[model samples]
Target: MGDFVKKLKTLKTEVEAEVPNHPSIEMGDVICEHFAISKPEEKTVNNPTRASNKENITEKERNKRRKSEKEKALGVKKKQKKPCGFCGEKTNLHTKTTCPKNPNARRMPKPKVS
Candidate 1:
């Protein structure tokens, strides 16, 4: 246990010595020195007409934009149909379980051996 602890301490010191100055240490010190320096400037708008004009988008354009934005944000993609293994037909309608050309449809039980 003592040897393990000694090895761990030596490893920690070696790592600290290898990385004498890291960006994280400097960033932490910079952040501590100027905590509120990164705050965004507040803008006060006096003209209500200008603000309304900025938001004057058509209903159809707004709907189209919203739909496109939603599709992009949700990562919506068109599904590609895969060809059937048995029939070689490209379809998204039927699966292997409901495929008409499935070989297992007319399968019979194997004969029991003594």
Candidate 2:
């Protein structure tokens, strides 16, 4: 009887410690509750290649991921165009017309005769 009571107390403390003090509700859970009343059904794929494909992604998705990774490696961020060094105007790349501070904004000078 005494051993049983001690086991019960230890079990209760273990359960209490396992549970979080303040659990956060996940955004996915809220979205699923709003749109999908029931749990989403999971389908198992049989194809080994499809299952083991790069992060289980299609070829197109893999290509897009690779491109984005390459861009990141090259230190390029999407949707954030760099401002021109000559002018402070935002442009993807510096151009003669876009850069007001460019000295060669006008037409190139004619070649000098020898």
Candidate 3:
């Protein structure tokens, strides 16, 4: 019985000595929790060539997209006309009347022959 008591005491002392006085949370534990919550490894489903004909888009759809882009580039949404640099009057590229470089340009008179 005395031997048993001594062994029990020794075991208790050993366990106590190994126990931490004030155990702090480890950074690895927090990192594991963050990974579990965020789940950054989830797969995405975007196609690499979806924006172009490589994705099997119909011809009509492609034409429509092209037209939409052209209209946007030409500022078709706004009706206000841009002024010509020379004329100071609103004119589009298709029907510009006066050259912007010389608003008051006049043809020079031809030199009289001697």
Candidate 4:
């Protein structure tokens, strides 16, 4: 038991020496205590680039971000009303998606042309 703990502690120290700022090596004392092993005194380093648990951005900025996200989600959306793509004539009846003139389009009852 003692030899295993000594090996585990040595292995941990070697790993810490290799990667001082590793996330897994952050809570050295907690890990040691959990495994019934004692660790030497070590300085805890706080990451400078880490974000705080607070909302710093403005409401307008947040709204703008949300608007852009919505726009991206609904990218290049076609207009409900547009000119006939197949027949190449502007009309109120249908667009390319619903145009009867389209060869590959499903059989649909086309409006009467008078």
Pick by lDDT: which candidate is best?
Answer: 4
Model 4 Cα lDDT, one tens digit per residue, 1-114: 999999999999999899859455558767887899886568587568745343466756754543444464354343344567787776656667667778777656346433
Is candidate 2 or 4 superior in lDDT? 4
- Taking all chains together, the TM-score of candidate 3 against the true structure is 0.21
Q: What is the lDDT of candidate 3?
A: 0.58
Model 3: residues >4 Å from true position, as ranges?
A: 1-51, 54-70, 77-79, 94-114
Taking the tens digit of each residue's C-alpha lDDT, what string does model 3 give over 1-114? 999999999999999899867767688768878787543476777667545534456767766544445565566535566776555656443223344455454533223222
Please list all clashing residue pairs in model 4, or write none if there are none.
none
lDDT of each: 0.59, 0.61, 0.58, 0.65
Which regions of candidate 4 fall more than 4 Å away from where they truly are?
1-81, 107-114
Q: Candidate 1, residues 21-111: lDDT per residue as tens digits?
A: 8555577567867875653457665556533323457767755543444464344234476786667777654455546778664443223
lDDT of 3 at 34: 77
Query: Arrange candidates by TM-score, highest first: which order?
Result: 1, 4, 3, 2
Q: Which 10-residue span in candidate 3 carries the lowest summed lDDT?
A: 105-114
RMSD of each: 24.8, 17.7, 17.2, 18.3
Residue 78: error of model 2 in Å? 92
> How many clashes in candidate 3?
1
**Candidate 4: lDDT over CA atoms?**
0.65
lDDT of 2 at 19: 89
